[model samples]
Target: MSIISSTSHATSNTATLSQRLTAAIGASILGACLVYFAGFSHIEAVHNAAHDTRHSAAFPCH
Candidate 1:
């Protein structure tokens, strides 16, 4: 009775804490990846575009 309920209560609390911690870590990792990929992809596109537009005299890519 008392012992069983207390054990269950403790387990529930621990589970709740674990859920919150997992959600926080997942959100943080997702946000970081989104920011990094967005920034890197945009920068890469700009760099490639610039390289493609270089004048023939100054170009070594040909």
Candidate 2:
């Protein structure tokens, strides 16, 4: 009985870890899409803002 309980507890922890990892990956993809779109936006203000950010981060946008 104790072994069974411990096994279930480990599974629960694995599920929680999987959920957190999925969320992190999803958020990273969304953020990358947002940045890519904003960086290339036709709107000058948005494009410049992203460009400035790249410069600030020393990302070598040029």
Give all candidates' CA lDDT scores. 0.67, 0.86
Candidate 1 regions off by >4 Å? 1-15, 42-62
Off by over 4 Å in 2: 1-15
Ten-residue stretch with the least lDDT total in model 1: 5-14
State candidate 1's TM-score.
0.43
lDDT at 40, model 2: 76
Candidate whose TM-score is highest: 2
lDDT of 1 by residue, 1-62 (tens): 35554434444434588899999999999999865565456688765665565544486754
Question: Candidate 2 has what TM-score?
Answer: 0.64
Judge candidate 1 against the unseen true structure and give its global Cα lDDT, from 0 to 1. Answer: 0.67
RMSD of each: 13.6, 7.1
